[model samples]
Target: MYKYDNFDQTIVNERVEQFRGQTQRFLSGELSEEEYRPLRLMNGLYIQRHAPMLRVAIPYGLLSSKQMRMLAQIAREYDKNYAHFSTRQNLQYNWPDLERVPDILADLASVEMHAVQTSGNCIRNTTSDQFAGIAPDEIEDPRPYCEIIRQWSTFHPEFSYLPRKFKIAVSGATHDRAAVRVHDIGLYLVKNGQGETGFEVIVGGGLGRTPYIGPTIRSFLEKKDLLSYLEAILRVYNRYGRRDNIYKARIKILVNELGKEEFTKQVEEEWQHIKNSVLILDQKEIDRVKAYFTEPDYDQNAGDDTGFESALNENSAFTSWASRNLADHKVAGYKAVVVSLKAPGIAPGDATDAQMDFIADIADEYSHGEIVVTHDQNLVLPHVKQADLFTLWNKLSEQGLATPNIGLLTDMICCPGLDFCSLANAGSIPIAKQINEKFDDLDYLHDIGDIKIKMSGCMNACGHHHVGHIGILGVNKKGEEYYQLTLGGSAENDAALGDRLGPAFAKAEVANVIESLIQVYINNRDEDERFLDTYRRIGMEPFKEKVYENN
Candidate 1:
């Protein structure tokens, strides 16, 4: 976790003062609701269906136990007793008072967190694998770079107002848990053929009315030129990205209109003008940023714990949860634990105040007082000792945070649909619940392994449905809720957009349609093949044929 320097602290403090003034003006009627709306949105305050929603950024998904406790306190004192964690690795308070939002921002600044860039058409939160530092296959920790980008993009004068929102994701691991391919800009930290570390840059990727798989704009960019390269990409996008139509403003639409070659050429030409300048990497600045993320003092020989294996064999629930929720840690005898937010009937990503407190306590006790928010709407304790696995599981289960379904059908990624979002035409949380109930069986869900099921209320694709192994997009047709399905999509290393599975299904029929598609995959898959692999191998024809034929 990056500690705030004087400059960082000053900016946050100043922004709070700025927003406080904005709040005053809005409340005093200097700005109309229409006028105040965009200004407030830029500050991460949304006037939701019922009340104002305040989104607080958890940069690169990192949170200290102290910070987590502060969030818990905020939820308890200010708004509802719960907060919804978003796919962008942020937290949203769904019922904050409009007048008190400035105070909230002030409080967040105390803990080095704020709401800026969580909303509006600016560079949004940069995301990465929750297990970045501890992931076994990581090339390097991505957080330092993520933090650098976070600092650079925060209120960058030229990019604060873009044609549409911009999102960026980075991945240090071979596995793309960050969903990099579907973001506006995806940076894969890589080692080139010459053994120099750099980024494999992909551009023009997003999901909305139009879904696009980002094209590789740069095969490799030296690590030193990161900021300059990113500036080049954004410069090109801001200059040429469509603004005439709201429906087609995303970089994805621009990329589609101009093919990848032209897009790449434009970015390259832009980079040529900016590269090797003062904006290029400064070793001193890189060190200053990277210093905050130096590895914690971890025990060297924390070898395999036989006690954990014994516990696994004895408790079936614990074993199941461990299997799905635990990830391989780079350090021997340590594990990365996923605290699933999609437990049974609870709204996906809604963590009550008590749960946050519980997580804070657990991180303090089990991990090194650190926690991470995953883009999958889950929380991660990246360095839990293997010896303490059973204890942590029991504690989490007691707190309703231990759901043994990760990457399974029940672990759904959903947006705040019609229930809270003014933009949503249909409810996504209920749809997730409906599907969750339909596939509640632990064994069954585990058998239909590693499926990323995402849902969005509308085509804005906040839930990232376009990249789900089984994507569900909500639509309203003649006042009835309907869902369009897409299959074969993926967010991993070989990211690809899902093909449409066919016609939309009525809300009631969604579960059945999904089950039928899963059954088709089961029938066609080879030994131990995941849903995505099977979908890619056989294509959409088999699943599409089965799903629509029965209808």
Candidate 2:
């Protein structure tokens, strides 16, 4: 983790004082609702349906144990005794007092954290693969560059108020765990044929009312030009992107209207001049940033843990959780542990205050003193000793954090729908709960393997419904909530939009509809194929009919 220098600390302290003044003005009626709207948004405060919501940024999905404890304290004192982790790897407090938000910001600033750029028209959080450094498939760690972008974009006056909100994601791994393809700007850290490192820049990818998997704007961009190239892209979008209609404001809409060829040409023309400018990152600075992320001291020669294998064989529960929750770590004798947040009956990604402290303790005790928030609404201990798997599992299970349902049908990504969001037409958390209860069998869920079911309250695609293997969108019909289903969507490499599966279903009928689709998949799947693989191979005709025939 990059500790904030004196300059960074000063920046946050200044913002807290600034936000305090703005908040005072708004409350005292000196700032009208129209005037206060953007100000509050910039501070990551939203007046939701029931109460004010505060979104705190967890930069590139990395947070220290100390920071986690701070969040737990915030949740305990400021809002309800829990916080919602967003799909973008940020945390949301649903019921914070608007008057006290500045205090929250000040508290966050104390721990080198804040809500800056977590919302607003400027650049949002710069996310990356949660398994960035530790993933065996990674070419290099993406965090150094993510941190660079985080620093560059933090207070850039030029991009603070874009046509609409902008998002960026970087993936260093061979597989796209970060869902880079659907961000406004997606950077794939890659090595060229000559072994030179750079980015494969993909632009105009987003999911909202109009969904798009961004086209490759640049085949290869050198590492030195990362910030400059990004500036060029933002400048192009900021110059020409539509500001007339909120619905048509995202860069994806602009890219689609202009076409990729023309967009690429414009970006190239802009990049030509700026590529060699001062914005170009110096190798020494890049190395300095990279130095902060070096691996924890490990037992280098601790090759194979026989005890870990023995634990797996002896305990069925431990083995089950390990199979689903544990992923291969880059280092030997270590594993990346996925703490599933999609526990049954609870809102997905809502970690209670006690749970946060517990998870923080687990990270300190079992893994390194750090945690990574996964895009799939899970917490990850990126470096856990293999021998400690059982102990970690037992501790997590006791706290209702160890579901062992990673990538299963029940492990769904859902937005804080009508329950919290004013924009949501229908409730998403309830739909997730309904679907989760319907598909509660672990064995059955595992059999219907590698399924991603995402639910969104509206077309904003906050839940990333457009990229799930099974996408569910909530719609309001005659003031009643209905759920619409989309099939074959994926956020992985070769990202594609999901196909809609006919008419929407009532809230009560949602669980049955999902079951019908699951049954269809099981009946039609080929040998060893995942839900997505089967969907691509077999197409949507079978699943579509199964879902709609009885409706």
Candidate 3:
């Protein structure tokens, strides 16, 4: 709920006009594709297999009702009436005319939104927990810091073109819902022994061809030095990170080659020079930014309603949906509801314009006119009264938006594979569909409980496959799609990369492989143990044996 000021509005307006001129020149053949690639990519436009894909940044996945309505309008007028939500909490339109991108940018600017830094080798979106303010376990709200980073990194001349794209995630919660450990820079907001809040900085974490969980370079970083320290890390990477090969260009790769101690030393040296610079945040400036994210007023008298309890007793369907979709909130008598985008038959995270509009309406009517896009390819109404649960469920169910499969197998994180992405080696959407339908039983899914199935069409890991409880990476083996499995991975506080299963399964065998793995879990799991807990306890051998028995 951060609002744009005159300075913010002016900057966006100027950037839109600048990009508009660049686009016109590219279309008029004044610049060749080679010359225009960087320009277009910096503006978040990608030439996909079928059409130009435009990614719009949703900063820290927060959006107002008015902004959500504008997105719905953009999808209807510019895209093919549907948009895809990405793992970075960004939205993508698969079919947008290149000529009208400026118009879309102009429309987005009006809403304090833009596509800036969504693509190319600069800093990408700064992600945080979707449950930032409402989560009971949170240390502090991370959105204000995320906003600070957004402003600092937006077209920062020093980091405009790094060796490769950079990612940063902030987690104010005890549990890491933001996948902080898998980002290039994971900032865990922490309180020291003195009860002074600062950051526990984890550097060089990323997933791709060479997956790495960045080591903690600093156990404690002062809150005032966040941006300065971040700049130091980037400066170190930019100065020494490989530019010789695109494969070795990421900061993770550099950290791996140089060893964590050396990397930490370099960053420390750089930080000493910049720690007291203009980037050093003051209490006044921090408070000013935090003011934009103040909590909404609520009725103190609003407690658990008897009507809601009655509805739960009477309607099994509502009960099931509520159990899966609703999350605990810090505020009593309030719930954070996740709106599933992974309904059966549709591509994961693809929401039609109508669906987006409906969500906006619901957000206004129930969630204080605010919405949140989760990093897990879902939308969230972060503040819903417990009394209005049944009514909200009815509205959501009517629109096919209430799937009740949050944290289940069907609620998987997936990328636009061969369906749209040119770099993809196989189709991920179809595989997700197969798994979704295979695990169609709600009772069975609820019984199994909290299985994260993340699939990527390639090693780019756009789907965040490496961090899923069950990670599936698509590969091409002699023109055939082969799915590789990895198990025991998680993006939580105790984050660890998954180990690869013995061999890759053919596209047809992927679902069967998943089923066999699940059966292994069912056989070995202790009572009430989740998929991840079972995997951790028994390791991957049992599942690997079950999966490759026929191979």
Candidate 4:
């Protein structure tokens, strides 16, 4: 984790006080609502359907145990008993008092966390793979570059207010766990034939009312030119991106209208002027950022723990959880344990204050006091010793954090729909619960295997519904809530938007619809085929026929 220096601390502390004044003025009626709107948004405060929502940034999804404890404290003292973790790997406080937002910001600054850029039509949080440094398939750690972007973008006057919100994602692994293809700017860290490292840049990828898988603009870009190249892209978007309609304001729309070739040409032209400027990162600076993410100390004799093997043999429950929740680590005798937030009956991506505290303790005890939040709404203890697996599993199980449903049907990504978001067409949490109840059997879910169910309450696509294996979008038709389904979408290496399954179904029909689709996959799948594989092999006709047969 990157520790804040005096400059970082000073900036955050100053911003807290500045926002404190702005909030006070708004409350005192000295600043009109129009005047306070941008100010509050800049500080990551939103007036939601019920109460004010505060989104706190967890940069590139990294969190120290101390920061986690602070988040738990904020949840306990300020909001309700729980907070919601968003798809961007940020945390949202749904019930924070408007007057106390400054206090919350101040508290967050103390822990080197704040809510800046979590919302608004500015550059939002830069995200990366949850398994960044620890993944076995990674070419390099992407966090240093993510941190570089964060430093470059925060309060950059040129990009302070773009035509629309901007998102950038980087992936260092062979697997695209960061969903880079669906971001405004996606960077895949790669090595060329000569073995020199650089980025494969993709632009125009986004999901909303209109969805697109970003096209690669630069096949290879030197590592030193990263920031300069990003600035060029932003400059192009800021100058030409549509400002007349909010719906057409994202950079994706600009790229679509101008064509990928023209967009790339413009960016390249702009980059020629600045590529060798001060924006180019030097080796010293790169090494400094990389130093913050160095690997933790490991025991030399850590392999082949007999106790862990015995526990796996003795306990079927632990075995199942391990199969689903544990990921392979690059270091031998270590594993990345995913702490699932989508346990039965819990709202997806939400954690109670107690659960947060318990997780912080677990991180300290098992993962070297570090926690990583995944964009799929799960937490990762990225450096857990294999020897301590059984005991860690038991602790997580006791706290309701060990669901063993990672990447399963029930471990869905969902947004705060009508329950919290005013823009929502329907309630997503209830639908999630309905799905959970319908698919309560672990054996049945395991059989279905590795299906992603992402639901959004509206077309804003905050839940990333467009990229799920089974994407569910809530729609309002003639004042009645209905759910639409899409199949075969994936957010991994083969990134693609899902195909719609004909017509929308009533809200009550969603769970049954999902069940029918799953049954179709079960009936049609070949040996060892996943839901996505089966869907792609047989196409949508079979699943659509099954889902709409009784309608």
Q: lDDT winner among the candidates?
A: 4
- For model 4, residues 75-191, the per-residue Cα lDDT tens digits are 999999899988999999999999889999999999999998888878989999999999999999999999989989888899988998999999999999999999999999999
The per-prediction tally of clashing pairs is 0, 0, 0, 0
TM-score of each: 0.97, 0.99, 0.99, 0.99
Question: Once superposed on the true structure, which residue ranges of model 2 sit more than 4 Å away at CA?
Answer: none
Give, for candidate 1, the lowest lDDT window spanning 10 residues: 296-305
Candidate 1 residues lying further than 4 Å off, grouped into runs, are none
lDDT of 1 by residue, 127-246 (tens): 988988888899988998999899999999999889999999999988888988888999999999998788999988878888877888888988789999999989988999999999
Instruction: Supply candidate 3's per-residue lDDT for 56.
Output: 96
**Which digits, one per residue and each the tens of the lDDT, describe model 2 over residues 471-500?**
999999999999889998999897999998
Any idea what lDDT model 3 has?
0.92
- Superposition error at 81 for model 4 (Å): 1.5
Error of 4 at 152 (Å): 0.6
Model 2 lDDT, residue 274, Cα: 92
Q: What is the lDDT for 314 in model 2?
A: 97
Selected candidate, larger TM-score, 1 vs 3: 3
Positional deviation of residue 519's Cα in model 1 after best superposition, in angstroms:
2.3
Better of 1 and 4 by lDDT: 4
Stretches of candidate 3 off by over 4 Å are none
